[model samples]
Target: MKQELLSLILPSRNEAEGLRRLLPELVTLLPDAEIIVVNDGSDDNTLAACTEFPVRVISHPYPKGNGAAVKSGARAANGDVLIFMDADGQHKPEDIPALLEKFKEGYDMVVGARQSGSHAGAHRAVANDVFSRLATWMTGQPVEDLTSGFRVVKANKFRTFLYLLPNGFSYPTTITMSFFRAGFSVAYLPIHTPRRATGKSHIRPTRDGLRFLLIIFKIGTLYSPLKLFLPISLIFFFSGLSYYLFTFVTQHRFTNMSALLLTTSMLVFLIGLISEQITMLIYKDSD
Candidate 1:
C-alpha cells in the first residue's frame, strides 16, 4: 500500500505554545494527514492555536486527563491508521514516518522507544526502565518501552481495547499490555525526544510513579495471574518446610508458625488457581 489514510491525534492540555509550533511541522511533513488536536480543557489558547491549521480540533468542557483525550481522538478518528503522540513538545514530528514505516511491515502496533538521553530526567529514565523490565517479564517478550506516548497503530485493532483504558495518565501502559495479551503483533523503534518546549511536566516522581507501579501489577494480573502469584506461593511453601525441619530438630514438634505458613501457601495457591481460570475465561475471545 503506497498510501494510507493516516490520522494524527495529539492529546494536549495547557499547551497552546507547543501546539502552535508543532501543528505546522506536522502539516508540512504529512500534508494529507487528518490531524486532530484534542484540547483537554486547557485554560490557555490551545483551541485558538489549532484554528490556523488545517487540522480538526476537539475541545473538552473540563479538564479530562490524557487517557480520556486519547479515547476521544480514537473514537473520532476516520482513518484506518492512527498515530498518537503527545503535544507537550517532547515527541519529535520527524519520528512519525519511521513509526509508520515500521507499521507497514505488518505490525499491529509500533512504539517509538525513547533513547536513554531522551528521557526528561535520569530518575524518570530509571523508573521507566524498571517498568519496562516488569512488563517484559509479564509478557515474556522484550518490552522496550511500556509507557511511551508515541506510537502508530491500526485503528481497528487499537479501538478494540478502548474500554480497557483508564481515564488517567497510564493509558499507554494499558493499551500496550492489552495488545500483547490479545496476541497482536507489537514492535519497537528507537527514537530520540527533546524536552518539552512549553508548560511544566506533570510527572511527579512520588505521585505518577506509584500510579505506574500499580498499573504494572494490575496489568500483570490481567495478563497472567499465576506469573505473579506462583512465586509468592512458592516462597511461603519453602519457608514452612524449612521452619518445620528446624523445629523438629530443636523442639521435636511442629510449631504454630510452620503450620500457619503451610496453610497460607495452600490458600494462596488456590486463589491463584481460581484467578487463572477466571483470566482464561475473560480473554477467551481475544483470538
Candidate 2:
C-alpha cells in the first residue's frame, strides 16, 4: 500500500511533563507524520516545552475546552489523514499505525477503543458504557467507545461536523454521532490507555457529565428525531387510547386525561416531523 501522510493533533493544557515524554515517543512511532499541538491557555511551561520539539504549536490567550483546541489543530493541519490524541499521555503513540490501517479498508473513521481494564475507575467505565450504548441505539450500529479521544479520520469528511461541535469534553460524542448519521463507515480498534504522566484530570464529572448528556440529546434530535420522538409519542398515544377505552367501558364519559395524552402525542409527533425536515435540509446543503 502507498504511504499516506498523517497529522497527529494533540490538545494540551498544563501538561508540560506529559508532552516531554509523549513527543519523543510519537516521533519514534510516526517518524513521517506531522505533529500539531494546540496549547489551550496553559499557565504552566507547556508552551515552552513544545518549543523544544519540532512541532507546530497554536495557542489560545485564554483557556478553551479540549474541543475548541482540536478544531484549531484540524484547521491548521495539512495532512490528508487526521489523528487526534490527548496530550495527557494516556493514548499511546504506537496505536497510530493500527488506526491508519482501517483507512486502507475504505473506512472513513477509526477509533482507538480503550480497554475496559484501562479505565481510571469503575464509575468512569460505567459512564463510558452508558454513553456508548446510547450512541449505538441512536445510530443503529455498535459504538464501542463514544468518549475515546484517540481516533483517525479522513480530514475533509470530519470537517463537516465542526459547526455543530461544542467546546467541551463531549465533542467526541457529537463527532461520532454525526459520522454515523451521515452514513460514514466507522470501525474501532482496541487499545490500552495508560495513566497520565503528570497533572490532574481537568474533567469535573458532575458538570461535564450533564453537558455531555445534553450534547447526546442534541445530536439525537438533529440526526434522528424519530428515534426519541417516536417512543415518547407512542407512550402518550397508548395512554390516551387506553384511558378513552376504559372510560367508555365504565363511566361512558370521556376524561381530561384522555384529551391531555392525545394532544401531547400529536404535538410531539409534529415536532419530530419538523425536525426531520430541517435535518434533511442541512444534509442536502452539505451534499
Candidate 3:
C-alpha cells in the first residue's frame, strides 16, 4: 500500500489532564502523523500542558462547540486523510491504525463504533442507541454508533460537508448522513471506548439533546427531504382525504372543516415537493 500522511484532529475543552496522557500515547503510536488539537475555549491549563508536546494547538479564545473545533482542525490539517478523535481520553490512540487501515481499502470514510457496554452511564448509553437507530433508519444502513468521535475520513471528501456542519456536538450525524447521501463508501470498525481520564463531559442532556435532534432533522431534510417530508405530508393528506370521503358518502357534500383540512394537506405536500427540489439543486451545485 502507498504511504499517506494522516492528520489527527482532537477537539478538546478544558481537558488538560486527559491530554497529558493522551498526547504522549498518540505521539508514540502515530509517530509520522501530525496531531492538531483545537482547544475550544479552555479556562484551565489545557493549552499550557500542550505546549511541550509535538502537536499543533489551535486555540479558540472563547468556547466554540466541538463541531466548530473539528472544523477548525480540519481546515488547518495538511494531510490526505483526517482522523477525528475526542481529547477527553475516551478514545484509544492505539485504535488509530485500524481506522487508517480501513482508509487504505479505498473507502471514503471509516468510523470507529464503540462496543456495546462501553459507555459511561446508562442514560448516555440509551441516548446513543436511540440516535444510532435513527441514523440507521435515515441512511438505510446499520449505524452502530452515530455519535462516536473516533473516525477516519478522506480529507477532500470531508471538505464538502464543512458548510453543512453545525458548531455544536452533532457533527457526526451530519457527516455520516452526508457521505451516504453523496454516495460515498463508509465503513464501521468496532472498538472499545474507555472512560475519560479527567474533566467533566461538556454535553448537557437537556440542551444538547434537543440541539442534536434539530441537527438530525436538518441533515435528514438536506439529504432526503422527500423521504422525511413526504411521509408526514402523506399522513396529513390521507387523514383529510378520509374525512372528505366520509362526508361525501354520508351527506354528498364536503363540510367546511373537511375542505380546510384538504387545502392544508395539499399545501403541505406542495411545500415538501418544492423543498425537495431546492435541496437537490443545492447539493448539485455543491458537487
Best by TM-score: 1
Q: What is the per-residue lDDT of model 3 for residues 184-236, given as tens digits with 9 covering 90 to 100?
A: 89899999987777899988887776786576576567577777767777787
Candidate 2 lDDT over residue span 207-283, tens digit each: 67787667667757756987878888999999999999999899999999999999999999999888888777766
Task: Please report, as a residue range, the 10-residue window in candidate 2 with the lowest summed lDDT.
Answer: 278-287
Model 1 residue 59 CA deviation in Å: 1.7
Residue-level lDDT of model 1, residues 102-190, one tens digit each, is 99899999999988778477777876788899889999999999889999999998888788788888888888888888899999999
Worst 10 residues of 3 by lDDT: 278-287
Residue pair clashes in candidate 1: none
Listed in order, each prediction's TM-score against the native is 0.94, 0.94, 0.92
Rank the models by TM-score, top first: 1, 2, 3
Model 2 misplaced stretches (Cα beyond 4 Å): 1-3
Off by over 4 Å in 1: 1-3
* lDDT of predicted model 2: 0.86
Better of 1 and 3 by TM-score: 1
Clashes of 1: 0
Model 2 residue 93 distance off true place after TM-score fit, in angstroms: 1.0
